[model samples]
Target: MNPDNAATMVAIEIQQPGGPDALIPAERPVPSPGKGEVLVEVAAAGVNRPDVLQRRGFYPPPPGASDLPGLEVAGEVVAAGEGATHLIGERVCALVAGGGYAQYAVAPAGTCLPVPESLSMAEAAALPETVFTVWHNLFERGAAVEGEWALIHGGTSGIGTTAIALCRLFGVKAAVTCGSDDKCAAALAQGAAAAINYRTQDFVAEVQRLTGGRGVEVVLDMVGGDYLPRNVQCLAEDGRHVSIATQRGVTAELNIMDVMRRRLHLTGSTLRPRSTAFKTALAEEIRREVWPFVESGQLRPVMDRTFPLREAAAAHARMEAGDHVGKIVLTV
Candidate 1:
């Protein structure tokens, strides 16, 4: 494929590992697609917790990944690499390891999915990371069955809200825990069966109460540390608990008797370091199981706020403030 006219694109670069102020707008060379990849002219990109962690130097990009921070994007494919010629000119959303915080980015051909025309680029931008994550951890790993009760640890986070929506769409009962009453109300409005105020009430008690004292079938946990033990307690017999992040702390201890008695499955995964083939398989699973809901509007992207591409520092600041209820995005 031929290159675009411009040699470089406006992108966000982390000057150093520190605060959000480290995110500076700068010009960088537009990247070319490799074999089995597509070069996309990005219209918008999703801001996620991993991006913030990377900016703060806690989470470094995997080997050979872009240094730029964005993990997901919505854009038009400008060119395709060998054996991926079908992607050119397609408007799609993709889960990228990095390099999304720019005017142009390259994504694995297998990771790209068609965006529904009804949604804005901003909404589509918000899909890849959250959708793939929820699908992987919540359904694929956690085995959240339809008509079963599930507890989500962070109700208003990008991953949490998407989990709630997908659970509701798939007929699983969803209960979430958030820091504020407003967030609880927001979760309820998004089709969550229940929302617990984690700041005040005990989530274990709330989950028990909401599930009629029977406990839930699955728990989608992002807050690790002490929550790990409590997550196991929140589940029913033969239950599954999946961890996608360790927001509170990394280490925790659990009761040996709890697992033996309940037959619980404790598992966790980090998405960024996985192989392209693994992500490609996940993309296919999402296409068959989740994309219909997205395209039909049964499930919707919950976008809380958006900032200009240049004001990414401000966006990160807002995210750190902990007030927004849904996905934060940057419009290019």
Candidate 2:
């Protein structure tokens, strides 16, 4: 590798997983594109919950994935691997297995999506991970549809904001729960028909009241633990409850009778552990169904704030504080 080329790259690494302090900056060689890959000179990277978990040692990188923390990136493609066409020096955003926290990262050819002509690199970086999660959990598995009611927990989160925008674009009525009145208002502004402040309000009763006792058709829940039982109770007949994370805790006792009697469907998944083929299929679906909305400016990322790449620890701290209304980004 040329010394000048090698000198251009930087990365954040975990010396030992623990807390925000674990993210340490270091120099790295600019990676070369391998077969079926493209080398992106990252302009920005999205900060996600999984990055926090990874920094805490609670989540490990999947096989063949980068050991660094970032899961998504937006940048110009600087180099293309052999057999990779249709992309060269193109501004793109991609869902990567890892390596997004670096100044340079490699993305599989199939996973790269054209950055919307309307969005900045920072805004584009925020889309792939959150949009992929929302589409898969809410529409694909949860079977959410137009004119149906969808309830999202953590409504002020990156996932929540994206879900709200997507539901609105799809003509679905959306309700969400957040931590405060301010967060609730933010959620509502993002297209949530109703935003419940979980700290001061009862989400179940609110959902029932909002829907006139019918409840919502689908609940996208990230808060597990005792919320699980109440979540099932808040579901409409034949409703689906998809649990994506256990922020509150995983194990919970729930009434099987409710599930059987209501004919409900309960399902959930994590994206990191999934196969590349699965992600490729998802990327294609996003391109076909969701990309147009982004292109037309109907759906776009809600960026809370951005920090320089060297300030990754501060970014992680802000996310951990739960003060953000949307995605936090690291600009390279």
The best candidate by lDDT is 1
lDDT of 2 by residue, 267-318 (tens): 9999988887789899999999999998999888998999999999999999
What digit string (tens of lDDT, one per residue) describes model 1 on residues 10-63? 999999999989999999988889899999899999999999999999999999
- After superposition of all CA atoms, the RMSD between model 2 and the true structure is 1.4
Give per-residue lDDT, candidate 2, residue 53: 92
TM-score of each: 0.98, 0.97
So what's the TM-score on candidate 2? 0.97
Instruction: Report RMSD (Å) for each prediction in the order shown.
Output: 1.1, 1.4
> Quick one: how many clashes does candidate 2 have?
0
